[model samples]
Target: MLTGKKTIVFGERDEISATATSACLKAAGAEVVYENTACFV
Candidate 1:
């Protein structure tokens, strides 16, 4: 179980996975710090 820690989620243009990851992490009681999106050409 996540008690005390930090979590970060990077979308990287993947909205589906990124949102899921963020939710999961939040549910686990993690302090999400940063999120960034990167577009690749």
Candidate 2:
């Protein structure tokens, strides 16, 4: 697992991918330092 590791999650705006990704990461013991939902350019 990714325990004790810090990660940033950039979720696509108007999408669920971020939510799923963050959940998966958390389940793997990863620390989501920051989570953002935005329209990436």
Candidate 3:
């Protein structure tokens, strides 16, 4: 469980979008500071 932590997510565009991924992280008690869904591939 991540509590009082800061996390930055990038390019979570698989089955779940960036938002959903961030939400899941938040649910796990992580502080999602930034979420980027830009996939440059």
Candidate 4:
């Protein structure tokens, strides 16, 4: 559903769900970016 879309995922840590979501996005041909919550600290 998210083809050729850009997305950013922010979270405190890289959890299982986060990883799975990223994989799903990639499979759907999306450019996924990840940011850790600690970066804002």
Candidate 5:
């Protein structure tokens, strides 16, 4: 389900939430390239 799209994430890395989200998004045909705890998106 990853489309391989450039993506950015900003949140507390307290759990696998971020990871899972990224994974799901990526699997959905998104090119995820970057990830951070703070991004002015």
Candidate 6:
């Protein structure tokens, strides 16, 4: 489990999955910097 750690999640295509992961990380005491949903062509 992550505790007092910083993280950034990029290019998460699924909204539910992204939100869930962010929530889990925060609950585990992680500082989520950013969550991006955009993709490059």
TM-score of each: 0.55, 0.67, 0.64, 0.56, 0.48, 0.63
**RMSD over all Cα atoms, model 5:** 5.4
lDDT digits (tens) for residues 1-41 of candidate 3: 57778988875455457888778888888999888897555
Clashing pairs for model 3 are none
Cα shift from native, residue 35, model 3 (Å): 1.1
**Whole-model alpha-carbon lDDT for candidate 6:** 0.73
Q: List the residue pairs that clash in candidate 2.
A: none
Q: Is candidate 5 or candidate 6 better by lDDT?
A: 6
Is 1 or 3 the stronger prediction by TM-score?
A: 3
lDDT of 6 by residue, 1-41 (tens): 68988888655454345566788899999988887665333
How many backbone overlaps does candidate 2 show?
0
Error of 5 at 36 (Å): 3.3
User: Model-by-model lDDT, in order?
Assistant: 0.69, 0.82, 0.78, 0.66, 0.62, 0.73
Ranking by lDDT: 2, 3, 6, 1, 4, 5
lDDT-superior candidate, 2 or 4: 2
User: Which tens-of-lDDT digit does each residue in 1-41 have in candidate 2?
Assistant: 58878889988866756677889899999988888877765
For model 5 the TM-score comes to: 0.48
| Residue 4 miss distance in model 3 (angstroms) | 1.6
Cα lDDT of model 1 by residue, 1-41, tens digit: 66567876787564445666777888888877876566564
Off by over 4 Å in 6: 14-16, 38-41
Model 4 C-alpha lDDT per residue in residues 1-41, reported as the tens digit of each score? 69988888554444434566677789999988763343333
C-alpha displacement of 9 in model 5, angstroms?
Answer: 1.7
Q: Relative to the unseen true structure, what is the C-alpha lDDT of residue 20 in candidate 2, on a scale of 0 to 100?
A: 76
